[model samples]
Target: MAGPGGWWGRKSTPAKVETYTRWSFYLIALSEPLVIGVTALGQVEARLALLFMVPVVGHVALALVLVSRALDWTAGRRPQPLGLLGAVGAATAVLAVTSLVLTQHGPDGEGAETVLGAVFGTTVTYGVGMMALAMKERRRVVWLVAGYGVGAGLVASALGVPAVAALSMAAFMTAASGFIAATSCFSVWLLNAVYALDEARETRARLAVAEERLRFGRDLHDVMGRNLAVIALKSELAVQLARRDRPEAVEQMIEVQRIAQESQREVREVVRGYRRADLEAELSGARGVLRAAGIDCEVSGETDGLPAEVQSALGWVVREATTNVLRHGDAKRCTVTVRRPEGRVVLTVRNDGATAPHGSSRAGGTGLAGLRERLSDVGGTLDAGEAGDGEFRLVAEVPLTARPALEVVS
Candidate 1:
């Protein structure tokens, strides 16, 4: 039931580029028969026109198949389409020869030469362009185009065309086919670049997550490692003393219990600090991260008098929203604003170039759900959805008066 607009909105940036490139080629292929074949029908006899149209239509169909397979191959979705490329090349040569024969021996009309020349030139140019998509090397594409030009000249000479006319045919084929070939090459390059950029963005987000995890792990180890070592040594000493029936064993055991309790409290503090995000630090971090990722990020906010709980809740919102902007949509600009109004702190993260549909639940994953839970604990609210004009906005509001008591996990 989705309309074209809805369907288009759902596609990612790379997907959209791929669709445009693919359909552009499809239109080019379809235009051949629609334009050139119709012209041929008007110039030639109906029966002869059908004869020429049959092969042209068949070539167009073949070109369509090649376009899909060639694009798929370029995208790494399929193996190189060597067989199809060969078949298309052969078909193009056959069509070119047939058109030349028609020009020389078939019905002589005012438009026959023009129509035949178009047939020959169009078939050769289309074939070379489609074949260019399968080629990864620019040198190979250059050679392919040059070779086709030479082949066109040689074929014309074999059909008794004059030397000058044959050279002219070669030049025309070279220029036309080279244009199409260059277009095909550029399309392939642009598509590949778009995909590479998308991959890099995803990789950067993953690396950011991974680096944070490593930091947290290092913090936990630094807090607990020496304390656990001390506990083990004290327990061993207590065990040895108790075997000798010594009163010092009780003292050592009590010391061991005290150290264990202290270690537990220290671990809890570390975990609490790890979970708590500072609004100022998060805003600074988001600005740097987004800008590093090529997004123009402007952050205007202050957390000077905000309570710790309010800062923590909104800080989490900023982190999650920034990550989504990098990983989900193709955001080019991000604006994060924090303001205190109506006895509440409002934090808004708005970004443009969002590819997600309007009113979608979330962009990437359940990060939004987890964020909502975190905000709810501090009496904060989270709102996120696509705004108009390819923008996404996330807003988190926490009352200044709401300061939920923090509990230390034992």
Candidate 2:
């Protein structure tokens, strides 16, 4: 692994990055012998083989440096070019010197042949190894490999050892660069496509959720709207009939009860889809509960300035508070306030709900917990506790969105 201090290094990343890195190393590895080997092949007598060793050494050094860098990249490091090039030069020198000592000298005929083979084989390995380490872009440095291939091909050719075969190898190495570039380009495109597909999937999920909400809203409007209209009409009819004749009015009275009961049921069901209450609905529901419980209800201040999200949230608070008041506090009166002044939307529900019931206190339940979460989701909070002895007040405040209703409607 290359450390942060150095320029060229491998750092851990995706497989595609690694693949390109591997290919780059391959190019470097194959370049060395081809470069020096081909260029020196035409006349390999006297110091010719020694001359051949120069590029081979250069190639080996370059390969070592590149391999180190690729490893560094694999380990999540980026490399510096000058430092990387220096390392490559150093490695080629070592390998070239090693090859010179071991194989550059000719022993007798058989020994000369064995030494040459060893040198050539080692040279090839080092060349390939270096290319494998260099970054994909850096594999351009492996053009030196083509030199080796061409030289070897030419040596085999000039000596009548079959030059075409050697040059063909050169052609193959030369062609690889284009293949490498093409594959890298394709990988980048594939990555982008995957990201785009993920984004599309996410958008569809959001749309599905929204459609489900809209469908529920329609069903709620149908059920509640029709029942409320029928109940209102039947009540009116019962009133008129009561004035005209007692027996006939009594029959209308039964029908009114039936209609009222059905409307209430429908409202509760509609409420399940969304606790969809506006300012008016909450006030009306609160008023009825207070009247039924023989408590006085009072609300103050305009809520028109509040956003629909905030209004809907506060409406839940009002309902839960009112329910607690009647069922637990035995409240005689309750006051609710919704107002915006000084850049804040304020909501308060207060009652003598802090009083214990028959010398016992009641534990809060899901309604209150749910109201807290609801308010929090709208960037508000619920605070319910004793304002003083025998007095309970729940205060909630949220930022006001000026066009609250229109925002919700949209």
Candidate 3:
């Protein structure tokens, strides 16, 4: 359990979801203005059009900055941009409202309504931009957003635009409020979901590592525990016999030495066996490991009557393939098949979600190259490439015509 000192941790990034929401906000920023421009085409005076452009552009820049910072925060990046852009956007929104109010001739006319309509529409976009920054900063600023919304609504009302109407400037502003709520709240919810997923994945990886370590420790204890105990007891007995000056004491001592030597040899054999690769054992292990990693693995093969050399070579291939599947790709299903048709043993590992391996060339890292070398020693060939539709296939074929000399494993 974590201690009290570490109970409440700092906030983190939203990762995968940040990119999506940022792009969504970008689309909103791009489209909202175009929409308002179309709606106010004939009503706005030419002299005051440039004033409107400033706030729109400023608000978009501010929103982009917010989403970009949010992305950086989630990804654990450093040196984020300063937060002054939101302040600038807020000031620009004030200017826009002032300009719209000054230009209005009367409260109920088409020209007055159009300017107020554009002002109110973009005010909602500005509110969204502020809410985004608050979320990125992980601060309690909903009250600030609420206050800003009220202020914008009041500005609209001053020019004969109500906050709520069935088919007027008030209605569009009301929709803007809804838009702000949906985007802000949805982005937050999605961020939390993404964070939870990342946490679960990390937990799974840590558990797998811990389980492997425990298994190795248990195996070592089983292999050497009893042998060491027997050696200790025998040495004590031999010492007592030697103190009594009996000739049998020497024999006892010699027997103890022989037993110690045998135990040493046994330990070496045990360690070597633990390290050596066996095809059947590799297949079984691969299945268990893949299943533990939430991947469905189906293996089909006949292991009987195979040359030991071929099995060992193919075992390495299976081991390497399993590691790559777990570490490199986001695979969900893996199929391993072994066939001995036409006097040659063919082993194929096919898996979905295989990405192109990164590094020099496409043949993958040094591990596959080593496997290729091992296979070649037994008249075998290895081929690996994409099988289309996001599938990766690896095939290792070794001829059975020439029986390979058994290779000693140390």
Candidate 4:
């Protein structure tokens, strides 16, 4: 019923009145076999003329409806792909029907039946093809819908589908349509779900980093604050006592200054560990810890000329290895080597011996996991275990040109 005036009166997106409008060609396409079957009962001489009456009634009504729907879609600015499907489907159905009617000599004849059947058969084939070629697996339900279409064509050809049989078949087809439509709609749903989850995860990650930064700042304040206050008080007391007890006060004041300077450096490096990796500071820290623990620490190889990324990652490896030696090794000494071989950076941390059960290795810990993740982003890696007789070692290699700070330090 949509005319020039009527088509202008609707809004778009979630298009209204598409149920009947989109399907009008389907009714035309469905009735092709019916008209041919009906013509089969008529006389040969007048059959063509009578068949013309069916086209004017059934075919023309069907075509007008489809065209009007296309116009409505265009006016409403329907999506290009859906609009294309509607246009193509309508055109194909019209062509198929026209060809069948023109090729027919008369009613009740073999040639006429063959032509009409082929027209419907081709449509069924196309529907099946679309379903088969659909990108998503669930969309294959279009096969069942296409099968139903073929069955409907067969039933309509007889011009005598019982009401009960027609209803049953229609119900089956509608169910299949639901499945196909659901498959299409699921893609949109999945995309939205993935997008929402990604945003949530990113938010959580940011929160975790913020929380860790806060914790680090608090720990630094607590540890260094008390130590610095003690050092300051000792220095003041030593200065007052220096006027009388010169020898004892001189030693105390020297000790106080040394302790205060070391503590201040430690605090600066701890702050850097939270926000950055400072190579020279980390190396100095490692040297201090191992040397204090009665282990002779040797740092060798050229470290001064390395890129920032290589230096930083190697610095982490040094930190973790020193931490391990302190916690587990009862070694006399540890040799730390940084080597650049064939344009790649390598770090080796070797301890003489460990005070632990024989023939066992710790599976992994957070420090190791953190190192691995950092290395992996830059196409680098860590390999750690016993490397020689009675010696434990950790080795890390990174590309000199790698940009881990840009890629991973986030």
lDDT of each: 0.86, 0.58, 0.66, 0.57
Instruction: Name the top TM-score candidate.
Output: 1
- Estimate, for each residue in 1-410, the C-alpha lDDT of model 3 and write its tens digit: 84532222111223325656767766765775676666667766655555556666666666666656655654457444445445644654675576457546535567656765575566565555544544444343454455445665666667665446313443454456556655666676677677676577667667966996787678778766877787788778878887887677787768778876777777666655544568998999999988987899999989888876778778889988887776556679999999999889999998884453333114656877887778877889988877878677889999876355343424
The sequence of per-residue lDDT tens digits that candidate 4 reaches over residues 86-162 is: 44455545544454444433356665555455444444333332222122344444544554555554454345545
- Write candidate 2's Cα lDDT for 230-261 as tens digits: 77787788788778775777777788788777
TM-score of every prediction relative to native: 0.94, 0.31, 0.71, 0.33
Write one digit per residue (lDDT tens) for candidate 1, span 187-259. Answer: 9999999999889878877887799899989988998899899989989999999999999999999999998
What local lDDT score does residue 377 receive in model 3, on the 0 to 100 scale? 76
Candidates by lDDT, descending order: 1, 3, 2, 4
Q: Predicted candidate 4: what Cα RMSD to the true structure?
A: 20.2
Each candidate's root-mean-square deviation in Å? 2.2, 21.6, 8.3, 20.2
Question: Candidate 3 has what TM-score?
Answer: 0.71
Position 320, candidate 4: lDDT:
68
Angstrom error of the Cα, residue 213, model 3: value is 2.5
Clashes of each: 0, 48, 1, 0
Candidate that beats the other on lDDT, 3 or 4, i.e. the better one: 3
